[model samples]
Target: MAAKTDRSDININRSMPPGKIIPELVYDDLDQAVVWLCQAFGFKERLHFRNHRCQLVLGEASFIAKANPTLTESSNNNRLQPQPNQMDHSVLVRIEDVDQHFEQAVKSGASVISPPKDYPYGERQYSVEDIGGHIWTFSQSIADVDLSEWSGVLSDNPEDAF
Candidate 1:
């Protein structure tokens, strides 16, 4: 029998990974990508799915790393590719120390896109490109600034706000 979560009525499967939204990132080399991501970003491996995919977690956030299928395997199947010259999307992770995370990523040979910078919105963040070209932004909250202070509008209903 499936269990239920207090946060919501959704059924919780202990055998499956957790996270409201888990990004399944495609990489040319699954093993290398997993190692690099763990070493560079402090992600811990939560589950391994043979040689094709794996689940990784950083704090409360989790994402899947999948091997990009070959042309033969992609035939008549959904085609997934690694990030090309132009990125389709980027992953953002909130951590305790953006500076420490940035330094670790740099030491692990991650390509830096932007160094740590403080924003008026009360976050210190840094961006980097992984070995497979995926962009990841690490952020740390430095303050609890109101949304209006950063030109963000608050929802009329307090319940609508995250």
Candidate 2:
């Protein structure tokens, strides 16, 4: 006879919400990265795991962080992510006030990539890099300007080509 296993302690309702995308990031020092993210960008720690991985939440947006994987490990594809401060991609977030957020980030010692500026498409935006060298773009909508007026694009009719 097969032995019966107890299965009373399980929670199936705990999982990420539907239609939510969570981006994963790698850091050299996850502790400092978490602290910097909270201080500079206002993300609260949602969960911490094994001293190497953590989850950060800001409103409905969230991202998971893990220590950078070793390059010598033998795994499928045998590849590793680019070192911190070397990646070219950036994370963009929408906020209420671009200028105030920019000031706070600057005060928290984040490296400024671009100062706040208004764009024709109705966005006041700025860019910065955190201590782990992750580029972040914070933007706020300032207007509802028509796209056609700025770039002469997005025609109303299909025959308006060229």
Candidate 3:
């Protein structure tokens, strides 16, 4: 078998392009969803769209919410309708301060879930359930720790054990 040869002079892509990551959450009402999203996650509305079908929708952070069920269904594959005892999904949004964001959401009519708490992953995060049953978790980076410390308590094994 021949070993693969590198074509370094060909200008091949050595570094990956930045990824565009934006998750869209669908709701039964676009207007209400927009309000809740802005309040819960602090997403800024960017644009809106409408057609002859009367589907009023708005876009924020690459996410679009529809005012009607038909449009919501078409926008997001993980469309939701609150069940009796089960949850369909949740959205985790990165923020500067989860405690402050949680308080803001509470003031904006969001139902509190777990209060902002520190996690092993260096995040102080909290949860809120919107009126439409969408779960939004706001998280903030807390501290930088070694992976071992992050996993739990630091190991006491001798450094020479390796």
Candidate 4:
């Protein structure tokens, strides 16, 4: 089809949240989730909807923490639920220092899945499970490694790679 046009010049509604893609994580306890995420993950609370949802931000990134819907409150098609014991997905965040972030998360009682380790892809990263059982990965780029060096395939469209 056709290439997408840039929309940066267009004015966005002020009521809408920022970020091209914002993830909404469901939690059983909205208040506790907000507090734990702030303390452990260093996310600052941006906006809170009483007892329902809250927007969070770290640097220029943003996401939302929403309350899990009760069975009676939602239909199966639209119901939201907290993370189950088995992880189906994880959120990855780029930070300035992976080591420092891991330490702070550990100190704040995050359950460590993997400690910080450097990868051939030129990043230092770690994984942890939050209070709501959601997995989060924090990473820091340590070098600008060539994709070929790590056996990574480059996209034909260079703009799609980033």
Best by lDDT: 1
Which residue pairs in candidate 2 have backbone atoms (N, alpha carbon, C) closer than 3 angstroms, thus clashing? none
Alpha-carbon local distance difference test for all models: 0.87, 0.76, 0.60, 0.85
Write down the lDDT that model 2 would get.
0.76
Compared with the true structure, what per-residue lDDT tens digits does model 4 show for residues 1-162?
333336653446544456778898888888999999999999999999767789999997889998876622542446556454678788999999898899999999999999999999999999999998899999999999999999999778989644
For model 3, residues 1-162, the per-residue Cα lDDT tens digits are: 333235332333312111234344455666767766676556665555552011212232244444545554354445446642356777776777677777778888888878889988788988878766777677789887677765566458857443
Residue 126 lDDT, candidate 2, scale 0-100: 98
Q: Candidate 4, 9: how far from true, in Å?
A: 6.7
TM-score result, candidate 3: 0.64
How many clashes show up in model 1? 0
lDDT of 1 at 97: 91
lDDT measured at residue 37 in model 4 versus the true structure, 0 to 100: 96
Runs in model 2 lying further than 4 Å from the true structure: 1-19, 71-87, 152-162
Residue 101 of model 4: what lDDT?
Answer: 92
Q: Which numbered prediction scores highest in TM-score against the true structure?
A: 1
Off by over 4 Å in 3: 1-19, 51-62, 71-80, 152-162
